[model samples]
Target: MTDTALDMSVETGAASYGAASVKDYVALLKPRVMSLVVFSGLAGLIVAPGHLHPVLAAVAILCIAIGAGAAGAINMWYDRDIDAIMARTQKRPLPQGRMDPDEALAFGVFLSVASVVLMGLAVNWVAAALLGLANAFYVFVYTMWLKRRTPQNIVIGGAAGAFPPMIGWAAVTGDVSLASIILFALIFFWTPPHFWALAIFRKVDYSAAGVPMLPVVAGEAETKRQMLWYTLALFPIGVAPYFVGVGGPVYLAGSIILGGLFVLSAIRVLRSEDHKPAKQMFTYSILYLFLMFALLIGERLAA
Candidate 1:
């Protein structure tokens, strides 16, 4: 090859191998999802009976975020085929061919291992184990196995997301407790309604992707009914932190109001014939979880 042609070929190979930009990699991490995971983990750290050094607490949160992102990156890589078929996901790095699949997989695996190892070194093995379990559940259970196979995917898979707070609690206390379990339940019950609301609104995208989302397999009416039941279940679980002594009276009252609104949102979804209610519920669900965790964290800090 001529010198100029050789140089061009090298550049072409580099581009073909891994030309993805920083943002594309960030998309692989699913930063928006990471934010909620981090926040919940922080809440767990803040409310646990023992104090973690601020530096170690920060490390724990970082580990949780990285682990969550690692799972997300692996999920994106695994689902790239379905992602390409779904309009909403079509522009993602893997689906768009902006990133090499092997590179993405390696990035995810590396981050997963690093996050767990660092957590064990910097925090406690209990926290590290939970983080590893969450990552494995998200990747192997939720992404690889459950997601395409069943309508109960999010319901069963939601356990993976619920682990962060428990992990954070263990980072401080070095063991899981009733308070942490209540926190876990809060997120576990919340996940179904939250994702089902999105599924209701994105039925077409899910149906086209050949993913067996509740709405795709069970129908929207059934999905909405299930969402309502989960939201109803969430109300009591949201307030259980208060009963368990992790949350204060302010949290108790706030959770009541928030939980009421959540139920109302589900009711709205049930009554509406259009997607607007589901879309609204989806947006509100994010805010509800955020505020619920914030309330607990704030109340604990104030005490």
Candidate 2:
């Protein structure tokens, strides 16, 4: 079916040729998150110590993007009720009634299956399995369960987002390696502090939705303390690639400096009574992850 037909079917519960607009279809893809997934997967592919056919690599990345989009769509569908009440997610298609929940669910399931199957057939089963696992974890484990039940939701759910690099590495080598796992661990450990910082400022939204985010349950002070602790732990883990031979001087230095800055930001958040420090830490966390990944790829290229 055409994109418009698919969207209309989901939106109006009718199979029609015309729909609201192409943007409606694009909205289902969660393009913002997809960009990060694609970039990280590409970095993983680039840094893998093996050759992948250019066309196959392109296809693998496409599958990863689609899988990520599918998971995001499912998340939006499942969280539509809570999302409708949250300022941050009020404009999402499902919560806004721009699309039907059943339609979103179907669309997500279709994309998830297609992406995994295509990845398996076109590349290898390892990548496909990882992609499938990520989708399942996001949809079932994160969106359906942890998101509503506990503040540590993002801590465990974050693993879904961290799998792209491992999937990309597996696409090239058809197996998991310590290097890929290290990359995964870096993101996994980094997610709590990254998201909890946002929660510190957005705790009101989460509280209204009845989501027990750490900041809401533990109080902002304790949440900030936990953020600091996670950052401290993440520092050595982030820099581990250097000692493991997967990274070089550039990555080692970058990880240390970036990790130190992250810890400092967390400390500032811990010390401040206002939201300014949390806001700064929240914004800088994105840059910290991106720079760390870039340094990894740059070191690989330099070597």
Candidate 3:
């Protein structure tokens, strides 16, 4: 081929590849995480002791999911640098040059604004305000500031994730309550141990990225100990729903069994030489939370 023709072909290939890459950027919003946020938020809405129109409830859940996705997008945009260095995150959209960082930023901002506005107009201002705060806290406080700064980042930043259930409750009640706060507390306390287990296996990624995860900063032994401690603390809070009168015997029974299993897993992690316990604890944690909320909903529905 002539030199001019070869150059033109190369340029065309580059343009096509660039277009294809943009799709990957959108994937970095962590749709799975958004799904969990939506599900848990819906559970809260369903269990809350109030009557909301079906349409309004659906709108509230939609806003919560979109706000969470926006926060995830912003997190990806800001953490692109660190994400590039981590093995687990190196293939994310911005780091892989699938999408422009500015494009992601603008998309996140647009979603954040649109979600909040829709939520406020359709539901109560209280829910919409909480949604806005959660997004800002995740993007600016957790992703931009804390992720690289301290081992306690997950401990504090977890509040962002904990807000969804409370927002869901508030959307129906039009205010916050002790019951909503308890739901928030459940997720808040659960987050550190859940995340620390992953860090135990992924310590090298955090070390390479200069992120001070619990395992990277506190060492495996200390992280395991903390996980055990948190799991034990979680037991009481997990059962609090029963005393609060929101949960029935079914929920109480399930909470006790699940909480015992969680504590046992944490103890095994502390005792085991291999990382198998941590891995098991991490996987089971997802199941534990899902079942706990599911039982709560079942009780409410049966009542």
Which predicted model would earn the best lDDT? 1
> What lDDT is obtained when candidate 3 is compared to the true structure?
0.89
TM-score of 1: 0.96
TM-score winner between 1 and 3, please give it.
1
CA lDDT, every prediction?
A: 0.93, 0.90, 0.89
Candidate 2 wrong stretches, greater than 4 Å: 1-19
Clashes of 1: 0
List where candidate 1 sits over 4 angstroms from the true fold.
Answer: 1-14
Write down the TM-score of every candidate.
0.96, 0.93, 0.94
Q: Which candidate would rank higher by lDDT, 1 or 2?
A: 1
Task: Say which candidate scores most in TM-score.
Answer: 1
Tens-place lDDT per residue, model 3, 143-221, is: 9889889999999999999999899999999998888889889999999999999999999989988999989988999
For candidate 1, list the clashing residue pairs, or say none: none
Lowest summed lDDT over 10 consecutive residues: which window, candidate 3? Answer: 13-22
